[model samples]
Target: MTVMTDRPHMTTEEFEDLARIAAQQAEGLRLEFIGGVLRSKAMPDGDHGRVILWLTRICMQHHPDFWLHPGQGIKAEQYREGRAIPDGVLAHEDAFVGQGDWVDPGPILMAVEVTSWDSDTERRDRIERPRAYAQTGIPVYLLIDRLKCQVLVHSDPDGNGYETVRTVPFGKEVKLPDPVGITLHTEPLKDWVR
Candidate 1:
């Protein structure tokens, strides 16, 4: 039932080159390479932006030194062969400083995705994201599932994937694990997901 297949369509270098050209041809078009497959990311809707804004505020309030950077390109999966543009990448303020377009995921504490209103949201956000982030050993992968009205916190990456996953419905409180020790009062999320 895994979303990612074993075979990749192209090498990381080819994918990166294609991504660059694609971005130039179509403004705001994002491409991701994961599980050896190519996937396109849709543009965010207002609600999606709002959700990220809310999380950014909370992250800054609790950890001023940390940041929830939106649409940050990250090197992912084994041998840094995969690349993904996570909706939000949580890391220290200068984690990506002076880095190229796709930065290393080592300093990233968490990767967040707010479900989009699209056919690919389910596989892209719920399945591909966690697996990619976990395989890169990211400490956490937080998914704010708009359609499901729930938040899934994935942590404890055991290489292949995360070992622990905790889901909390909207309006309930959920604590993100260490490296990102922030307790979120998710009631406001109810407002944003609409």
Candidate 2:
């Protein structure tokens, strides 16, 4: 929480280096490249991690065609434009399965910041990142904002963005039938132990 430098953004290479260093050092921190910036986010709680895990698992059951890749420091491209890491992402075999990389062939689905307190950048991810991903012709963008304990689903991809299909909260029945057919009972998300 005590950084001396005023870093608004850094290149993909710099971000990768920092990420590697953070992993190697036992500083016990979490990080990601958000808004072209290198940031060390606060420690995530049980709720944050489990929600993503559950989302990845159940989503795959609903749509076996797409693979829900783990948030394992893999590089993702924004329609062959910008590069950043996602909390959780989906890789489709038809388009980008055996390709160069997400940045090279592009990923058709991605998730942005879902567990942070930086309000400004968080909103930017919910707003800007989705727009960028949609422009890449990606079909879905899910913003997991626990701030209000809600999962905002955007689909029906248009130019440079997706429509706000619905905001599913705890105890709500959520549905996404376009790129995938998933009806999730999200009350467990609100009960996040983290």
Candidate 3:
């Protein structure tokens, strides 16, 4: 059995390095630095993965210029001194370079998060993350809440959080504004099991 130890009060850079090393050691695990803390989570489950797949397909079919990356870590230098790993990220083809593992939030067009089983996870996805993304000036933030069966589209960042917030139920379609400019069919999301 592997032993796990907690390193308290680590700086952002230290946390990021630890996360990178941990990810390399455990291939399937995803580790992120959030608010100076190292947060680790398992790879997404079936339903979560399905939503990401559908989002990728939709983006490819409608907005070919944008690149949809699933399970990628985005670094927000201006926000909370941490890196966030969103469920899905939509950005321009040339937004990221080949050098680093983390993508800067500046080039990211939209960041997507799917709510998980834990309440802490849900709170982070719904509240904390949106604030972080907005502070980083990422244009849009999309949240898929499986527990609530709804999708929230957040835009108009104001450093602290979004100024505009729109919500749509699972069956309804959510029209992504301007740069993205496409309607997302959220029907398939309704079929999410737990």
Name the best candidate (by TM-score): 1
Give the per-residue lDDT of model 2 (tens digit) for 15-111. 6667667768957565666445555555556666777778878867866777666543444335243455566677664544454323442544544
Task: Tell me the lDDT of model 2 at 166.
Answer: 74
Clashing pairs in 2: 45-194, 46-194, 47-194
46: Cα error in model 3, Å:
0.9
Task: Show model 1 residue runs off by greater than 4 Å.
Answer: 1-6
Better of 1 and 2 by lDDT: 1
Each prediction's TM-score versus the true structure:
0.95, 0.70, 0.89
Q: Residue 73, candidate 2: how far off, in angstroms?
A: 4.6
* Among all candidates shown, the one with the greatest lDDT: 1
Give each model's whole-structure lDDT.
Answer: 0.91, 0.62, 0.79
**By descending lDDT, how would the candidates be arranged?**
1, 3, 2
Clashing pairs for model 1 are: 8-36
Query: Pairing residues by index, what is the TM-score of model 2?
Result: 0.70
Candidate 2, superposed: residue stretches over 4 Å from native: 1-36, 41-43, 72-81, 92-107, 110-113, 117-121
Clashes of 1: 1
